[model samples]
Target: MTIRLAAVAAPFGRDLDECFATIERLAFRARSEGASVLALPEACLGGYLANLGGEAAGPPALRRDGPELARLAGIAGDMVICAGYCEAEGDLRFNSVVCVTGDGILGHHRKVHQPLRENQSYAAGDGFTAFDTPAGRMGMMICYDKAFPESARSLALDGAQIVVCVSAWPASRTDPAPDLADDRWTRRFDLFDQARALENQVVWVSSNQSGTFGDLRFVGRAKIVGPGGEILAATGVSAGVAVASLDLEETLATARRSMGHLRDRRPEAYAAGF
Candidate 1:
């Protein structure tokens, strides 16, 4: 089915009320633009860590069944939304993403890979899985998890037609690029988004935090990528929503018809662990 998809690049901070307000506003705008699915940035609910290390305070840990998530579902209504937050399971906290609508939760994923000192803040997830949503069979990952090929591939293997990656990625701290466009990290972010989609032959939606938080300056380049890795719509280095409309089945079929990546996989040949 052809549906409009949107990925948002916006700032979110510690205030719970402010975060909800931002979500409500973004949801309204996406609905007005005919978007059936929306992807919001990682840690968009309670905010990301000020810095990756040195005992910086982390975002609030919320439960999967918390009232905050219920409020998010109410805002989602009919439209499907994938949002990231710090999840609390007893005393263990995880960096997690949840897909929801008015009917309630559709899917959830905790980040499987930790970058830098991120592991200090939250625990890693076990594996990847896809679940049904109004948009399609969708999968979710948070930030650094997308850097691993296996993460997206596992989701694809599970029959996910669409994958949403939410990130709190930042520009380089040491060798600061005066222009964010020239930042190598920004290039990596875009490259990973494209490469993951191309490799999996699945529609990819990428959302990231914008502006600055504490010591980090986020690279805001939210985008919607087609199955062939072509960028359908992107917000560039700004805070906005990148929206695009296309038939999911048709696009996937066209991309896979000649040489399907999934169909051609030689899983048994690569068992040596290079």
Candidate 2:
């Protein structure tokens, strides 16, 4: 079945109300364009902690069934939303993503990788798994999670046809690029999106924060990738939505037919610790 996918690279800042408003606005725009699944950047609910310390950087840790998520689900309506937020479980906090519809959450994932002092505020996720959604078998990943190949590979092994990665990824920490589009981080983001899709023969959705937050400047390169590693649509260093339509099953079938990367896997060739 052909379905439209969208990724929002717009910044929502740290205001909860404003974040919600932005989500609704962008979601409406996506729906108007016929996007069924919309991927918003990590921390889109309340923005991300740029330079704040543990205590000062608390980005509203919402529970999976909390009112905040319920509200998000309400706005989600028929469109499936895959977005990142800070998850609160008891007294612990996690950088997490939830795939939701009007019914509720379809799947939830906590980020497994921690860069810098992110661990100071959020606990890392344990594993990667895929779940059935209206869009297809889908999986979730956060910013740093995509840096590791095993993360997406695990989801693909679990029968995921589409993988959504929401990120608040910043530009080069030290040397700022004269042109945001030419930034190294921007290149890395695009490379990861393509590599992950091609390697697993799965559709890839990557969303990131655009503009500046604190001392960090985001490289808004939100994109949608086909199973064959083609960039179907992209938002380059701008706060906007990228949308593309594809025959979900047909694309995957054609990509895997010639080079069945998953089916021809040689798991025995590598050691677990490698």
Candidate 3:
């Protein structure tokens, strides 16, 4: 079966209402385009700007069981919506990606690797997990977590055919000005996407935040990569949605021809190292 997927780019600093409006618009557009699932950028609901003072000063804007979830559930009818939000589980705060369908909230993934200023605002998740859905077995990782190959590999091993990544990657220069032939700004995440796609042989769908938030500007290269490391659809540096249709049968064929990594194992050698 062919599953239509949408990678939605969300601009920064948008409030919940504004974000919902944007999502509704995107959802409508996706539905028109025959998309079954829409994936929104990281921190799409509240904003990616981590207010250090705000986390400590007062209560969070939306808790996991708050009205926001109900609103999201309502917004997401039959189409599956995978979006990012701050999840508060009692005293523990986590940067989380939630999947909502008409049935209500389907799954929640807490980011395992927190980067830079996020360490101050969110706690890292302990274990990797995936959820079975009508579309397929879906898995999620937030922003910086995608940089690690093990994360996607873990999801692929868990029978996930498509892995969705929600990111608010900052355009702030982490390195000094370098002389490069190509655009260095995009190279960082591009390599991550290619590596993850090639290694896992699973469709990698990444939705990133665009525009500026405070001092940080977001990188807006949202894209979908196929199991063979081919770019299925890509959104340039702008706020828009990129849609692509993925075939599980094709992915299974690729996996079978490529020695079926899931079936072959060298785990004993790796475990011996541990």
Instruction: Quantify all predictions' global Cα lDDT against the true fold.
Output: 0.94, 0.91, 0.79
Q: What would you estimate as the lDDT of candidate 1?
A: 0.94
Ranking by TM-score: 1, 2, 3
Better of 1 and 3 by lDDT: 1
lDDT of 3 by residue, 1-274 (tens): 9989999776845467887888888888998999888889988887875443334532244687789988887888989989898788777778888998978888889899976666777778976688887788889899899877789888988888779999988664555233321346667777788778777778888899887776566668888888777888988767888899868777657656857656776787685633
* Per-residue error (Å), model 1, residue 18: 0.5
TM-scores of all predicted structures: 0.98, 0.97, 0.90
1-274: candidate 2 lDDT, tens digit per residue: 8999999898867789999989999989999999999999999988788663554656887888889999989988999998889898899999999989999989999999998888888888899999999999999999989999999999999999999999999999887789999999889989999999999999999999999887789999999999889999999899989999999988888899878999999888989853
After TM-score superposition, the amount by which residue 218's alpha carbon in candidate 3 deviates from its true location, in angstroms, is 0.9
Candidate 3 lDDT score at position 150: 82
C-alpha lDDT of candidate 3 relative to the true structure: 0.79
lDDT of 3 at 237: 64
**How far is each candidate from the true structure, as Cα RMSD in Å?**
1.1, 1.2, 2.7
Model 1: per-residue Cα lDDT over 1-274, one tens digit each = 7899999999999998999999999999999999999999999999999988934568988999999999999999999999999999998999999999999999999998998988898888998999998788999999898899989998999999999999999999988799997899999999999999999999999999999999999999999999999999999887999999999989999999999999999978887651
Model 2, clash count? 0
